[model samples]
Target: MSLSVARRTVTTPILLGLLLVAFALLALVVGSKPFNQTIIDIFLKVIFVVGLWVFIGNSGVISFGHTAFACLGGYIAAWTTIKPMLKGTAMPGLPDWLMGMEIPFWASAVLAAGWAALWALIFGAVLMRLSGIAASIATFAMLAMVNSIYSNWESVTAATSSVVGIPIVRSIWPYLIAALIAVFAAWAYGISRHGLALRAARDEPTAAAASGIDIPRARLIAFVISGAIMGMGGALYAHSIGIVTPDTFYLGLAFITLSMLVVGGMGSLSGAVLGVLILSSLIQILRWLEAGIEIGTTTFALPGGVQEIALGAVMILILMFRPAGIMGNRDLSLPRGAASDSQGQTGPKT
Candidate 1:
């Protein structure tokens, strides 16, 4: 890597890390329990969005199926971490080994991520063969298949019923660490040779192939890496809420995550993280308004569900005004007089 690139690799994450820590501390000190949970939710969203950035941003392939990995991870965490007695009572059909074993939440999370990545590797091996809309459709199909199975396989997944008794983790520290780990991992990958090669394929597939870039292989690697992160986030999510349901990782989540990525500038890691932060902050603010604000003799409140409406309108406006997103595919870095690199027409500007 060039010196500038090396500096960015170190500085970019430091900058984003400071931002995340600042907000985390602010939420801890200034917010109530519910508000703190909101912060945790935002941190998890960061993990999810950054995971999406690793694959979608780098490979230039929109994946509608990543949430399936999250679903898998969430259930795995639930299955492995919940008390053995509870598991036996709640999911009697589980294999004897699974029903008899329970591990700490952290270990379960790691296992969950591993399981999810294994599936990603298996699925990506097949799905990565196609490109453009074909690839996207295949991924969506994969998502539908997973969702349908999870929604109906009552024996293991509890089907549409929410699986309860997954330990609730109300602390912010674990989520903070997970989010930072995801950010740094993304940064490391974005600057790696494989990440650069994948972006090259994304921008100019024919030229990239001519130059001997293994497009599908590079994409599969990214897919697996991103899937691991998504799995971690999903595991964390289940712990946060103390429940796992098939619908929890379905279209609504997919839409919200994709919107954050698209609105933040899908081509940049900074955009991915910032997009979640900015949009989540907006949603929180609108929700607060919906809850009602008082001024002297009057109480003001937005109509119910107005937060979603306003958020959608705001996203549309932002897209209209700045199509590349708030960050516009640029890496976050300190200004170096006469030494800075130009933002290029590619994802992960390494």
Candidate 2:
């Protein structure tokens, strides 16, 4: 590599190390209330981003429908936790085993993730056939289709109304543990053979197929894993809020997650994590702005369209400048830099 490129390679890890430390600090101290929820929120963000990274980062695909798996998980854990005997408007069709089952929080959470994987297994068959823009459109349509069901399927989920009574057990510690697991899982997938296959297909679909790789299978595997992770995340989210509604499953979430991925760097998992941290905090900042717009005595109407405007601006800027993403395809740990020659002579810029 040339001197300039060598300098960049050396500097990258140093910068990432500093940023990781900063994120850790921020996670520990983002809230003013001091209830220690900021740390938990950080963990939740980590889980959500890592889950999204598994599919979009590895396969170079966008899925606008993952919220459904999250919904699936939320309902599963909610049903498992709420008293089946009382049967408040949770899911009317909740399994007989769940009714009065009274499983532990951890178990219920695992099952919620498993159920999410199962849902992906069934749905992926239809969705994986398409790729690029077509896949994105179909997956988005799938989300709309699922949203219709969730909005109306009250007997199974109390319809559009919210359900409560889910015990709130998740806190900073639980979030920490979950985040660690998520990070490890995401890292493992990045290097695993499945990941390799997916990457191969993503970079060169025709070549990968010629080598006997099944593009759809690789995408489906990633999809199932992504859905499972989202399920766990949803269960955690539901438990955190102690209640849920159909509104939680659609609209803002998928976009927020997608924004996180793109802003951080669609090509990088570390990008996804950074994207979440940045965007989550941005929401708080926007809310703060809205508050600032309000008068001390009377409320001033906060301006509309701020978030969409901001996110769109950021996405466009990133696309223009750092097209690979904030971190490119690298991370704070385990960065895979572009190759260099034995003498470290830099090639011409691509």
Candidate 3:
């Protein structure tokens, strides 16, 4: 790579990492417990949305099922981290070996990534064969199937009831580290040969195939990587709230994360991070309004459900005016005048 190209590669992740660090510091400075928790939530959303961007953005396929991987990861946290006695009472169906095992929160997150990736590979082997809407529908079916199984498998999953006793991680540092890991991982994949191939296939499938690209293989690689990222996110999410439930990682999460990606510009990594930050800030403000913000002498408050409506309206507005997202297809980079190669190229499009 040229000098400018190498610099750009390193620059994107650094800038994104700094943004996350800034948010963490802001939360610390505020020193409010609720605000700190909100920052942690934002970091988790960054992980989830960025994971989705890795596959959906590069492959040009919308997946309604990535949250299923999160669901898997969340339950893995419950199985591995809860105390043995608690596990026995809540999930009597767990095998003796599993019920007796308990690991730290971080270890569970690692295992969750692997477990989710294993399932992603299995499912992707069959689902990756199809493309476009067929692939999208198949993924949604995967989500529904996973949800149904988790919701009714009383022996292992505790059915629809919440699984408690997860180790709550209130510290913002671990979340910050995980979010940085996710952001760097996504950036590395984007600039890698496989990611380039996948994007090529996405933009011109016929041409890519004609040039001997294994389109399905490219997509499957993205699927597995994205799955692992989402899995880790889910595990951290469980720790953040100290609870796990089938419904927590169901359609609601899927839609919100997907919406963040879509609103940020599905094709841009910067968009994924920005989408989470912007929407999360809006959500927090709405929550404050709902709780009755004091304006001078009077208390002003929006209705309870206005947050959801506002989110929907903001998404609609973004789609109508900036369909490519705030960042469009371009990444956050140094100014065009800052650096250039002999051919006047700065770096790859992403």
Candidate 4:
């Protein structure tokens, strides 16, 4: 890359990091305990959305299966971090080694991520062979299979019942750090040769293959990387709520995360982060309104579930006007010139 391009590349991630830290600090200062929880939720969502972007944004493949990785990660945390007595009783079928082990949360998170990535590699090896809608369907099927197994595995997973006793980390600093790590990781991959090649294939597969890019390998790499991220997010999410269940990482979450990614602009890292922050802020506001917030002693309240309806309508309107997303694949860049693009300029360049 040229010096200017390289500088832009480095500066983009730095700007994003600063933005996230600023938000973290703002929440710490201004938010009460409940509000802080909301902030933590947003940070976790940031990780999940960015994880999705790593593959879907670059490879142009939509995956409904990523949540399986999250479910795996959450269970890993449950198996590794929960008290041995509770784990043994709740999941008696677990092997002695797994049933007896109770490690620190951080270590379990790492192991969870590694476990998720392993499965991603195995599944991606097979699923990455297919393309377009076939790949999408295969991924959805994989998700269904995982959900079925987790939901029915009563001995180990406790079936659909909630597993409790996860160590809660309510502090925002750890979550903030994880969110920053995810952003940097995504930025690093996006500018890597593999990421570039993958995007090229996404736009023009035949040309990229003609140029000797191994599309399947590139997709698999992205898939594994994204799975690791989703796994980490899941582990943190389990700790955040102090519980785990199959439904926690199922279709409802998949739709919500995918919507945030799509509504923000799936083609860019900024979109991934911004989508979560923006949509999360809207949801928090709606929740407050639903709880009857008072302004000048006149309480205002929205009906239950109006938040989802309103959010859906807003997403529809945004897609209608800006189908590409609010950012539309543009990187967050510092202003350097009066004009950046000349596609629709009516007069001569300044």
Q: Pick the candidate with the highest lDDT.
A: 3
Candidate 1 per-residue lDDT over residues 244-316, each given as its tens digit = 8999999988889999998898878889989999999999999889999999899999899898888889789
Better of 2 and 4 by TM-score: 4
Cα error, candidate 4, residue 221 (Å): 0.5
Instruction: Quote model 4's TM-score.
Output: 0.94
Off by over 4 Å in 2: 1-35, 88-92, 293-308, 334-350
lDDT of 2 by residue, 4-72 (tens): 534444443344334544655665576544335654666676787778888888888888888888888
Model 2, residue 44: displacement in angstroms?
A: 1.9
- Expressed as tens digits, the lDDT of each residue in 96-191 for candidate 3 is 999999998999999999999999999999999999999999999999999999999998999999999999999999999999999999987887
CA lDDT, candidate 1, residue 291: 92
Winner on lDDT between 1 and 3 is 3
| Best-to-worst lDDT order | 3, 1, 4, 2
- TM-scores for all candidates: the values are 0.96, 0.82, 0.95, 0.94
For model 2, the local distance difference test gives 0.74
Candidate models: Cα lDDT each: 0.88, 0.74, 0.90, 0.88
- The runs of at least 3 residues in candidate 3 whose Cα sits more than 4 Å from the true structure, single-residue gaps closed, are 1-6, 336-350
**What TM-score quantifies how close candidate 3 is to the native fold?**
0.95
Cα lDDT tens digits, model 4, 117-197, are: 999999999999999999999999988998999999999999999999999999999989999999989887887777878
